[model samples]
Target: MTWEVRFSGFGGQGIVRCALITGKALSMYDNKFATMTQSFGPEARGGACASQLVISESRVLYPYVTLPGVLVALSQDSYNTYEPKLRDGGVLIYEEDLVQPKEDTGRVQMYAAPVTRMAEEIGNRIFANLVTLGCFAAITKIVSAEAMKNALPGLVPDRFLAVNEKAFDRGYEYGLELLETRPLSIEEAP
Candidate 1:
């Protein structure tokens, strides 16, 4: 089985880091094969950034995603750019506070999390990406909690590892709450 995941947001949001961590979780910890590719806009910070990961139980034959099975849109521009390319029955995870998503014409199952807000509550907004990663793990159940946690220590700065873990946990908790309620639309998301 293969899962194509695309993580998109503006620069400085750790878009590429999210994919790298997830790929590590899937490949090194979860016994899966993951290949990642990244894209950055012309400008450095505050510009469009995207990272795609192809995951499978076996070797990955393709490095790029044809139609992402999971689209994590953290910015409005990313949502607008990639939402239409999501495959039927795809999973859409977005920042509830940032992205105002359009109606999905296909069989896409959309989920929203207030990752940035949650990260701010944790402390700073920089941890928002980790929070989003937590939500991704909870909603998708593709990466194990143990795997996600294990992938953290080395990837993030030593001083901020604790905060990153906290952000991940917060997001994970919120995601579980969302799952329990199963909010139907972006309007229904909390």
Candidate 2:
């Protein structure tokens, strides 16, 4: 089976970095294979940014995520842009504080988590992407916690290592909480 995930937000939201870190962790530590690609705006903060991930247990030929199994949108613009492309029965996880999705897209399961608020509470609002990553990890178990721990040092710069680690851990735990409350089904996206 294969999993296609898309992460999108404004340029400085770390959407690309989150995709890369997840792909690398799955490839390096979890022993699962993955590929990642990204697109970003010219300006840093306000422009659109998107990253896609294709993951499988075996060798993956294609590198693009045409129909995402999971769509993580951290901003309203991103949500509005990618919502229609999500596969039926796919998952749409968004930041509750930043985005308000349409009434109900029955084809996709919707999850609204306050990742930005959680990150700010942790004293680093920039770690919202990491929080979202943790939520993804918990819901899917696509990458192991140990793998995430190992991937952190390489994914983040040395100066902000501690903060990044904390952010990752916070996300991981929050994801677990989400899982315990509402487990994600493994059914294929239609």
lDDT of every model, 2 decimals: 0.89, 0.85
lDDT of 1 by residue, 1-190 (tens): 7888999999999999999999998999999999999999689899999999999989998789997888999999999999989877778999999999877564788888989999999999999999999999888887898899899978999999999999999988888888887643222110
Clashes of 2: 0
lDDT of 2: 0.85
For each candidate in turn, the TM-score is 0.93, 0.93
Model 2: per-residue lDDT, tens digit, 99-118? 98899847787777899999
Candidate 1 lDDT (Cα, 0 to 1): 0.89
Alpha carbon deviation, residue 41, candidate 2 (Å):
2.5
RMSD of 1: 4.4
